[model samples]
Target chain A: MTAPSRHALVPFVSVDNMMKLVLHIGVERMMTELAAEIEADFLRWPLFDKTPRVASHSEVGVIELMPTSDGETYGFKYVNGHPSNMKKGLQTVTAFGLLADVATGYPLMLSEMTLLTALRTAATSAMAAKWLAPKGTRVMAMIGNGAQAEFQALAFKAVCGIAEVRLYDIDPAATAKCARNLAGRGLNVVSCNSAEQAMEGAQIVTTCTADKQYATILTDNMVGSGVHINAVGGDCPGKTELHRDILLRSGIFVEYPPQTRIEGEIQQLEADHPVTELWQVIAGQAEGRSDARQITLFDSVGFAIEDFSALRYVHSRLKDSGLYQNLDMIADPDDPRDLFGMLLRAGAAQAA
Target chain B: MTAPSRHALVPFVSVDNMMKLVLHIGVERMMTELAAEIEADFLRWPLFDKTPRVASHSEVGVIELMPTSDGETYGFKYVNGHPSNMKKGLQTVTAFGLLADVATGYPLMLSEMTLLTALRTAATSAMAAKWLAPKGTRVMAMIGNGAQAEFQALAFKAVCGIAEVRLYDIDPAATAKCARNLAGRGLNVVSCNSAEQAMEGAQIVTTCTADKQYATILTDNMVGSGVHINAVGGDCPGKTELHRDILLRSGIFVEYPPQTRIEGEIQQLEADHPVTELWQVIAGQAEGRSDARQITLFDSVGFAIEDFSALRYVHSRLKDSGLYQNLDMIADPDDPRDLFGMLLRAGAAQAA
Candidate 1:
């Protein structure tokens, strides 16, 4: 009991440390590990107490809190999106999250999720493709070669066994950066001039554009049968990726249906529009892909549960690697009722 | 701009350091400063984006997230309540919060609020008493002398000119502890055997009992004609402190009506029951303590805006004090699209 109490102090991995840790682990390995965690979590999805992320939207941006508990463990993430942040030399999306012991409601770990988000997004995309894409799916079309593009490309290669990636972005420099980042990764990287060119001869199509407004990066005419569409960027209300006709044609899958109705591609459809939750497919309650010619779309609006899983994975890996620092975030009073005494003792020490 | 960027990299104050800083500042002085900040925030309450807190409830307790923004600044707190936590040598409540820049949506500070909650709750009560309590009110009766008692007593002393506190609790030891904590605070502290006895000759009454159920600590007979009541403990859907009749007899002031309607003493009242927002009173748009003998109730169930104010206050105080460490929580790529490159660089550094 004493040993467990002492071990209860969970180590926190800050953004800088996380970056160093992920780099040490290698991005490809990190993505593979994250995907495995997501898959493991999705298999036990019924054990979770899940809710749609709570959002506070302003004219300029939205701030959200995403919380979930797996009976004994709890997690939450705080994230914000401001499209105009680029003008201020900041990323439009930034986040941090925590994992806690549900039995005691004590936070065990706090982590930076900006990089984790990129990794998890890519991992989730690959996870969906593993079940929905064709058996010999080796080539992926990466649309919107932004901050998350390289991660998506690597996750697919590492998790879904993809050998080639064709990239396109409205910003030519972004596509070039994506290509340069993947220089020695051993995958065939093609920087295309148009989304259509990137889509040609690809088995998987991933759209992760960061436009804040509704933009059709993929149309029904551009999409082909047997292609697994990983829709990653159209995550908030009024922000969408595929044309309506494309969504109508594809067998759309989502993380959480209620959330997907408001934030995913389904937002453009009626509430009654049929969609299969990814957890259901993972849990074997529903089929993922019916045929080789089926057009499958994973409407990948980010969910809190994924962050919870990612945080837990990072915490476990950091513990195993002995690479994290303990954050003195909780007030550990010898006597729980002696909070005031703790304050006074600190004051007395300062005075002396 | 370069200097500011460098300043942003400073280490954050650990929870221990924040406690030390707060203690060094002295509780009374800290509460005084916090009350001023709350007052200033309330004056501009109309500028904020407010929402009811998101709560996840279980049989044992609840975990909640409270978020609010003032167009330029965003803040949120993660808190939990478990009345049985004391039996396990844990606090019935624990919390931490974040302050973020609204323009870029980046978390600027993350600090433990388990201790800060005590201070802010007391300061918020005192701020309300400043507006609603009788002029030069000097005596306060504190019912339920538990974890929050001393802070409440000191805040009233510092903010509302209260010179005496009469404390009472079901447990004689709790009352004794409260008396002992306030020994050197230069106030007349009396331990009372009963709530009615504690209320005698008191100009303001504060109830902060920690029962999880609807337990009435104050009855209509015990509350005097001119006393302003600060109700703190009745902050969840089922928990309440004062009798419904006591609320009907007094003019009720609330922080965020949508929230108070569900968590405050007013939860027992009808949906149409009229209650004045405390901010309106602070703005002079509504009446506060209309007559000399009229009872006033500041139904403080705690609000997100108050947390925002407290976070802002802490950020300002800790900026130059060298009490905080900068958390590398945000991933800032030289080129926003080159996140993968940053990871690669980190990997190279680790290898070297």
Candidate 2:
């Protein structure tokens, strides 16, 4: 048999390179592209393996690994949520992920998912809104103006054609920061005092609050008919956004039913409470937005498939930009039996 | 609040750095120190939050994430198994792990576990033997000698006081390689023709095969009373070393029962069959061996706690040597709300 030829090792995109690539690509264009990719992946949703994220929760917050595959490529995101981190001047959440070849079980790429996560999450929201939100929705109510607020505003502008964003946060400075960041981005930005003011006359309501408990950011009275609610932050078991009454009244949609049952707004309802998986609606396998006057809820808990799509998109983008560092993570032994040889070579090099 | 002092970014030990550190420390010393750490951790096993590892199996092999936590410290290992990788001059398994603080969910250290795994596996095997193997059990029958053979031989010498190793592999070159690697390491290493020949006059038999299928390397007839079998390679579904009859005839011990049920030699037996948890035995809650003539089998599937202990031990060593590089993996925004500010700073630095 011919000796096995060594294939070039896979390139890894470090956090520094990822940030540089994002800056070069322009965050808005990247968000728009990421949203398109998420939508495209959502359209072929059945082709992917899906599972609720495996989460390890502590008394403070949670750490989760979300994994999914499409029979060819496997992807997983490592993320942590520590709401109290903000008190300590850390982002409430941070993430990173890997994309690997299923054929060889080799990690093909690793990217910073912290910034990418914000972009993909907004993109996912935009993808859902394309099907679930009312046509020609121009105004959005954004609750909890934090790290994710800017991306959400821009994604709404690019994907759903939202021209106005009414932002509200308990901390007024956070709302001001969101508005200042979005200045000159061609959006009518309004800083509101409360969720009620933000939701007034808005076509879409988005709640991305970071508290690790059940906080009713949008009450039943605040939500209007013909509004699509993008509930982003109420993701762990005890954390929730909308009041249970609002979920009971609205037509609910989720990325994965099993995960949403325990983590999304629907977690408050019984296990049997019916909700439509967003993929079914995106694939035209189920209905979305039955009536313009009826409230619709896309209970977004963040799924593995979105990360898969995001990683694929980032890998492609990095390739086009020629931006990424090759991480020497995998050992490429000359002889499979000679792992010790690599160590010897490395040791000799260090000694020299 | 004083702007959250930039989060102390976690230090990452790349594969190259890890290899250099291992070579600098010397493998035998590292293995000895790792064995001590594993023993210490095993003794305090009840202080951990343990669970069966999460595995994703494909036709080629399996990828697993093994996570465990003490009340204060948490760690997890990401490893992949592909037996055919050796044919491509790649290691059958490659792994990396992280140690984090439970209080902040901040990863404190990241290290390549590919080499560390071999060291720790051998250390763990020797640790188990020290407690369960008969006193003065110097002659060890190492069946299916492969990449892990040299480490196992060295660890047996340092930890279990074994002076000789009888090695046998399906391929004679593997045994020769192991023998060559162990030359002048103070062990009387012998290459044997078959598993039966290797076990001859040996008090301990260790099966460390790589096949991803159930193959009985040892039968009841091949084993004698007073022999300790360290079963290491039968570590996934459909992979096993000993015959079911051998387990029935021997006093079986396992790392974690739930994991071993699906991955170890006991996988072939009925679920309700009684077996002693190694930790319980180590904690003195259960018996290890009733008599010198009793047969003891350590059906190890490689638990996460062992990896946690290994990571902690290696991190400590790396710190003492000052050998690890700090990875810019986590974003350290000065004004927690100013992640965008980091981009501006990077841009400004570039301009400067």
Candidate 3:
């Protein structure tokens, strides 16, 4: 009745504000923090209501709604992956997310999630590598140096203390762009001509190509023993990056089995292909790297809980950063039963 | 490489702007137009990708994501229902929605849907009543005079030429508030002390009480022959308004049977009980109001497509009304593969 109340105002983090926030707390430091946040959520995986993402797939792309709730707070992300979008100078994956209170069923925050998704995806990869990678891993072979390449490179340096990264892509310009961006970020950036060349001395190899087909970006011979394979880009049905033979030789670990079996690299294997749950490994309930010669694969298709963690992290940062704008998203009338009266008063105010 | 492009900016309709837009068009006229739009979408129901709403329920309330795509465009609404919210001076229901281009998977618009939802629910009820109500229906008996009551009253007046509305609520203050709001709206408003008194000579009866448990708002004896019942508030599992005998007497019509069977008033009836699809009736694929003596009921649980229609209607009106603000919601890089470079450039611009 007296305009919208404070409860009606949801904090919104725009793309501009998100970028400012990333810069305010340097990208590597933020990813390190995001990694810790994601790991903490992983520790309490059983408490979350993990709903498989509802996807609306068209011929060109897919739009998805991924939702999860941790009893007290609920969160969801609206994301789209359109490989064809790149040709039109649009991000292949663009996203936004919201967090709401479970008790009142009111939204708490709305944030642009494209950059945050990138950050969280990278943070998740580094966190998994922390559990599954060989000890003293120093170099990472980054194949398909697209938007996610630099983030993965930086996260490894921040979370796992990796000192160098070797980059390669089908598109050399992408590799060159990644190398240029990673120039002064303290990592030894090497632009390689071939995937094999990039993987020469690396202990971790990440494949993150953006095509929607089952194209093999890595083969069995290219991946050696003791290498942790962070397969980052095979995230939909019929879309995979590593050869089936490589998955056969590795100890596969995933965020969620039901989803990863259909969308991750394990889609190439049978339904019961025996992939370890990464959360169990992080919580010390299961073995990570059983030996130095074991090839541990973190089949990264992303999950709702990781996004929920990222949103929660951003919400926690908002009060200190003051980087969000108040959005009049919810309608709060003075008398909850008099919504129409509120509208009538609004009309009068406009007329005045 | 550069700043966000025009495509990155999505048009956002806040609650205040939504009120201004509604007032600009006038509530009755907007509901009339919205009814037509919803009817049009109902006619082409087969073209849509109908995904059941994903709901997260807590002890106190429930949050839901309802999504649908019409091949070319996709829309989703985030809504929450907390019956206990009113006791804390909060709305019992609140919502927001987004529309995206299916081809590129890019969001085109974001709008506060709390007000729009009330308008669409009313419009849908009136649209259904137009086909199922007795011919030349002139009076509507609104049983629950809460937030949704006034909208329902006005929609019936605008769409079905309802000349009078008899309003009644468990609490008299709600009825008083509703009566005051409808005073100068060109319809004869009557405040009734009981449910039976509200239905004195009305041909259309609308029940829209907000409670989480089953309650008998109307019985079979209270509903006379040829009355069209608009059941609005019984929209979740275990929540219903009409007596079981009343449902047995009425020819029930619904939105989506799979969903309505679980959430609508039909939840009180047998799972295999006969209920007509309202879209089929709108499309002439099924009969409506077969005979004057046969009672008709619209078990209105609401649907994603109805919300889709409302969003598309609002998007169409935005240009002429100019009541929206641009939100930097999507991330658009000069080169889609150079997202890192864009962030780097944003940092450089910030430093400059």
How do the residues B1-352 of candidate 1 rate in per-residue lDDT, one tens digit apiece?
1112331242555657777778668788999999999999999999898888887777788888899888888889988887878788887888889988776677778888888888999999999999999998999999988888888999999998899999999999888877988897899999999999998899899999888888889888888798899998837888999998999999999999988998889999999899999999999899898988999999999999889999898889886787887766677766666778877776666567
- lDDT per residue for candidate 1 within A48-166, as digits (tens), equals 88888888787878888899988777889988888777666677787888887766767888888888888888898898899889898999999998888898999999999999999
Ranking by lDDT: 3, 1, 2
Segments of candidate 3 deviating more than 4 angstroms:
A1-3, B1-3
lDDT of 3 by residue, A1-352 (tens): 2457898899999999999999999998999999999999999999999967899999999999999999999999999999998888788899999999999989999999999999999999999999999999999999999989999999999999999899999989889989999998899998999999999899999889989999999988998899999989938998999899999999999999988988999999989788899999888899888999999999999999999999999999999999999999999999988889989999887778
| DockQ values of all predictions | 0.49, 0.45, 0.79
Q: Once all C-alphas are superposed, what RMSD does model 2 give against the true structure?
A: 2.9
TM-score of each: 0.95, 0.96, 0.99
- Candidate 1 RMSD to the real structure: 2.9
What lDDT does the true structure give each of the candidates?
0.85, 0.83, 0.93
CAPRI-style grade of the A/B interface in model 2:
acceptable
Candidate achieving the largest DockQ: 3
Q: What is the lDDT of residue B303 in candidate 3?
A: 96
Real interface contacts reproduced by model 1, as a fraction: 0.58
Task: Estimate the lDDT of model 1.
Answer: 0.85
Minimum summed lDDT over a 10-residue window in model 3 chain A is located at A1-10
Interface RMSD of each: 3.6, 4.1, 1.5
What TM-score does candidate 1 get on C-alpha atoms?
Answer: 0.95
Ranking by DockQ: 3, 1, 2
